[model samples]
Target: MARAGLTLERLTLEGAELVDEVGTDQACVRRFGVKVASLYLHVKNSQELKTGTAPLALEELADRAADALAGWAGKDALTAFADA
Candidate 1:
């Protein structure tokens, strides 16, 4: 059954978190307390959720890299990126 107050955006975000914690397992739907059909209303399937999350994860990594590289240059920037 669909839970009250659930939204597609929330589902997507939670799905992303789930992926980070447990990988691309479709069985993670059980953690959401909703049927697989319910998830379809928000995402096409587990693969779609995984696909949608990849860009977000990449963007976050890019942001962290940018922050780490800020005000640094040459070997320092290289070192920062490596550490980050």
Candidate 2:
């Protein structure tokens, strides 16, 4: 059962990881009973689950980009961020 206090942000991040590992189609609410129930405690349904995953991926990408760009400059930062 869902703990009731879990936030959508947490679930979204988890869902995104799950999707990346096993593909988004397998990350279905109906396929993951506990995850589905827990996720629904935050999001309305499967579509919203995917919606949540998008921002999580973007945030991760941005964080990686920042880390790659840190302490770097000119072509180095540009190439690192771009390659990342």
Best candidate (score: TM-score)? 1
Question: The CA-based lDDT of model 1 is what?
Answer: 0.75
lDDT of 1 at 20: 76
RMSD of every candidate to native, in Å, equals 2.4, 3.8
Q: Write the per-residue lDDT of candidate 1 for residues 1-84, one digit (tens) a residue.
A: 556766666666776787778775465467777777776776667677777677788897899999999999999999999888
Query: What is the overall TM-score of model 1 with all chains considered together?
Result: 0.71
Evaluate all candidate structures by whole-model CA lDDT and list the values in order.
0.75, 0.73
Instruction: Give the clashing residue pairs of candidate 2, or none.
Output: none
Task: List the candidate 2 regions with Cα displacement exceeding 4 Å.
Answer: 1-11, 28-43
Q: Residues 1-84, candidate 2, lDDT per residue (tens digit)?
A: 565546667667767888878887346454445554565666787777788788778998999999999999999999999977
User: By TM-score, how accurate is candidate 2?
Assistant: 0.61
